[model samples]
Target: MSLAAQDAAKIPEEIEWTWEVRPAHADAKLPNVLLLGDSITRNYFPEVTQDLTGVANVYLMASSTCVGDPRIEHQIAEFATMEGVRFQVVHFNNGMHGWGYSEAQYKAAFPAFMRTVRALTLESSTLIWASTTPVRIDKEVGPTNARVDERNKIALALITSAKISLDDQHALMMEHRDLYKDDIHFNDAGSKIQGDQAAAQIRAALSMNRLPKAQAR
Candidate 1:
């Protein structure tokens, strides 16, 4: 079996889950955008959809699955094909979960993450890599920003080398620790801040410096 399969077989996480959202009655006239990340992404998703209202149909594929598990790649494929929509922009991230996997294992599996996302994008599809947010609580059992930072460094090197734009959410959140509603997730207000920034980035990517909002589908 492949290394990722081995890790999955030995998976240590107490629970595994995935959440997906595609705009209902999507506007074919507008371009599709996808936000792929974790629960943190989910928290900010509504605000992003609202911010980009009438501008784009925002879709979300947030999961507890981390980079080391091979399922992450398969799940991404499933989400893409299941929607059958060509995303104009995909803002993707991982590195918050799967603490059971070592950084070395993460590094080893990083290429699959890159390749999987790339395969799903079109020639015109814009890709943005968002750095994972910091872990605020000093938990003996969960994630640490130190590890998050290290993983960011690992991803940054590869992503920049691939010439993908970065959303830099890690740096953004570092300035707003006061917004943390929990150890890892942000409050609604804080999540709105993140969503606004994401909308702004996607706007810039779409070259919509000034665009009218359309009623959401």
Candidate 2:
């Protein structure tokens, strides 16, 4: 009935993930945006919402499982229908989990998941696919850097073919390995930087999609 109750009902009992909705200011008239990913997204989400203040309503849907996980599609569908709001942009990533799944298996499931995401959002909504951030070799216990790279390559090919915008978070973090606190998570400063990048990309995508009709003519 309530938003929380609805979220609870949507989440699978066996799934392990965190779902948080950051409502826009009640009086603030702005576009809605959704950010989907794992803990890396959780780390930077606050900064993203803050950075986009007065610009858009930012929502976050994060999971501990891989993007290929079937349960994630259910969570995403719920997020899209929350309060009957349609997001203007959906920025998403998921490659940190699913270590048990081989690269080929990951590749096979990715397109289907993207299809679900596309179906749930507005036809005009900008779908941005963020590559998984790099993991520190010394600290990562599940996915190694080599594995991350392999998965990312597959993701890139699929995302490009789907005609989705690529955010390339992997490249953003590659040069700042020191900013990472562990294999996959970033420190506060790192998160801030990531949030800034994500905000900029979302803003750009929104602007591009909202171009003046007269200007086009």
lDDT of 2 by residue, 48-141 (tens): 9888888888888887756545667777777666656777899988888767556766776787789877875776789998888888773343
Check candidate 1 and list the clashing pairs: 54-214
Error of 2 at 176 (Å): 0.5
lDDT per residue, candidate 1, 173-217, as tens digits?
Answer: 999999999899999988998999988999887764234445211
Report how far off residue 46 is in candidate 2 (Å).
1.0
* Off by more than 4 A, model 1: 1-12, 208-217
Provide backbone clash counts, one per model: 1, 0
Q: What is the lDDT of candidate 2?
A: 0.79
Best by TM-score: 1
> TM-scores across all candidates?
0.90, 0.86
